[model samples]
Target: MQTVASESGSTLRNYASILLLLGGICLGSLVGFIFGNKVEGVKFIGDIFLNLLFTAIIPLVFFTIASSIANLQKTERLGKLFGIVAGVFLLTVLISAAVMAGVMLLFPIDQGNTLRTIAAQALIDNPASAHQALTPSAGASLTQVLTVNDFFELMARKNMLALILISLLVGFATLRAGEKGKAFAQFLDSANEVMKQLLAMIMKIAPLGLGAYFAYQVGVFGPQLLGVYVHPLALYYATCAAYFVIFFSLYAYFAAGRLGLSIFWKNNLTPALTAIGTCSSIATIPANLLAAEKMQIPDYVRNIVIPLGAPIHKDGSSMSSIIKLALLFAMFGKDFSAPEMLLAIMGITVIVSVVEGGIPNGGYIGEVFAITAFGFPMEQALPVAMVIGTLVDPIATLLNANGDLVSAMMVTRIVEGKDWLSSRLNK
Candidate 1:
């Protein structure tokens, strides 16, 4: 009875905390809607919060990943963990692409003349600037994307993929080192704990920080949501929300039955809000980690999966890539439903979700690839696609970031067995 009462009290407090965070965001959104651009004043506060999270994430990712890997009882477990992670990522991306493609078939996203007019007007206004902006670079070499010439470059958040790779290598090296590496392994664990504490301290202000950020987001970009991009945005946003509610719940239940579903929804709101509010998967890592911990995911699974998933396992981007391609096909009068085109779009979605996802403005490469592949004029179609990417980014990030948590749960289920959640709860 005492335990039940304590559990009830804890659940209530958790809900209350979630309400406070939601209240802050709601209030900020209200301020933005009320004040419009005047809400810019508070953006600096949000920036400060973001800066602190960004600052801590580099070391946080490094230490947590390295520690998780180095401390694994068996090297075979590491390989198995990654194998399962890769499988889950691929399966989810395929599902996302297929779902979005089906939606496009049912209700085609036709920007009609509106997007073309907007693109042409922009080009006319500044032909040189528009061309320069829309033109894709040769695209970064795989070498450049995966590694840095200088070690210090890995410290930047943009190079998170590189950091994760290096962390894995270091962990493997430490694991191979055996007893000689014990001290360093201990150091990594200690540092990881410290970084977790630092992240907690930073997140204590998330309500304020996220509130201000959302204010700027709504105040500045809210108006833009209604223009030429409205139809596609509406479709994309609705699809993402539906995917989040239905598919993610299904994933949670698959991971561990009814208890898993309940725990996931209860713990997911804060991370979901963080993802939408911050609009960066990397930025939401800390919050996702916290939520995963609450879900009682093993440290090794959550730590490795969350950080690694930030770069590669993007279900949201998979959906967005398909939407962008469909939008372009609609604008250009291409038959989007052609068998070859759908197959090609699914292939590209996988590439965009995995390859371009980590690189800065990497979506440009995917968009340019889609445009060139489909024979659309880059100057016109690229601008329209870019606008769609920007508008859907927040919600996309919501799916991208939160998807990692559920993936982690699923990974835990596979690695630790279907009884994993039950065992944790029993403990």
Candidate 2:
């Protein structure tokens, strides 16, 4: 019998996934062409996928954040690591935001009225609904709904942010609560375990959700949209690509041992592939852990960095979100100043990276919160969410996963008191 550990299954599945994706795109387009002007099945598919993405968000966030935070409390050397991580986090935001803004300025997706028409079609198909808890009074403008206060108010109404905040509070409080919090912690612990098991089942359904988007994309836009949107999409994709390439290149070039491109690719392929399949850095933790070991990240750094990076170090996703948001604003002829876009990215980083810890489904849940945050109507939100959820995920998760490998190198270098930077200067 073939060993269960054989990589043959993985290699075959990777190719199979690519084939299915391409075929689905073709099939969805043919359906769209046949169905004509009245076709709205894409919207139905969008909704189903959106629901699938968000179904376990609240519970998953509550459990994982609580557990992860509780564990972090045991660390004493975190002060310096925290600072380093924050610096990396901020640099990531700045780089991503700048690249996105630069691309927006250069390409300027304002194809006169055609772009707006696309935006309108996307909106009609994915209309927003009240979260059942916090619908504003009649006739609130999208602008009014988009203000910072409204964002926070949504949190108060138990939206994703609210859930993240609650998880942090409960988790931190539990840590401080000590023996007094034991019973409560036990309850949460049990709840968290059960939810994760339930979550495994939810993940099995992701491809279904993902498939819907692929089906609709093929059915609606076919390969044609790729040509039309290629200009804008290329800019966005390049921005994401730039992040992993430039950052890792700089890190490796300066490292004393010289981190070769081949080694980097070899060590990271599994995590990247896993991220593509799972659409989540958080979900790909096991693969990421394995990749770290393969890359020779010390156990300590591997242990801490991967978990931390998964939640707050969304270098890929944050940048991609910024690009998408800029595109959305561009579609409406809204001219947000460069600095304002940068600021918005900063705010988004805080919201996405800090507040969204232990989210149940990293890709789906994060994308939902983001679609809503970026002020797309629920109609526009669904397809946009689906496309981005699929498109950005593999790369984003790969970047986030790779953060551990790099951080391990950096941290181990730090532990050894080696000045890799100084040596580069000497050379």
Highest-scoring model, lDDT = 1
Q: TM-score of predicted model 1?
A: 0.58
Segments in model 1 whose C-alpha atoms lie over 4 Å from true places: 1-77, 111-227
Write model 1 residue lDDT over 356-389, tens digit each, in one string. Answer: 4544444544565555444455445654565567
Please provide, for model 2 over 249-323, each residue's C-alpha lDDT reduced to its tens digit, 9 standing for 90 to 100.
Answer: 665443435543444566777777677665566767888788767666557667877777777776666666665
Candidate 2, which segments miss by more than 4 Å at Cα? 1-6, 12-26, 41-49, 52-55, 111-114, 121-159, 193-229, 253-303, 336-338, 353-361, 413-427
TM-score of 2: 0.72
- Residue 63 of model 2, lDDT score: 80
Alpha carbon lDDT of each predicted model: 0.75, 0.58
User: For every model shown, what is its TM-score relative to the native structure?
Assistant: 0.58, 0.72
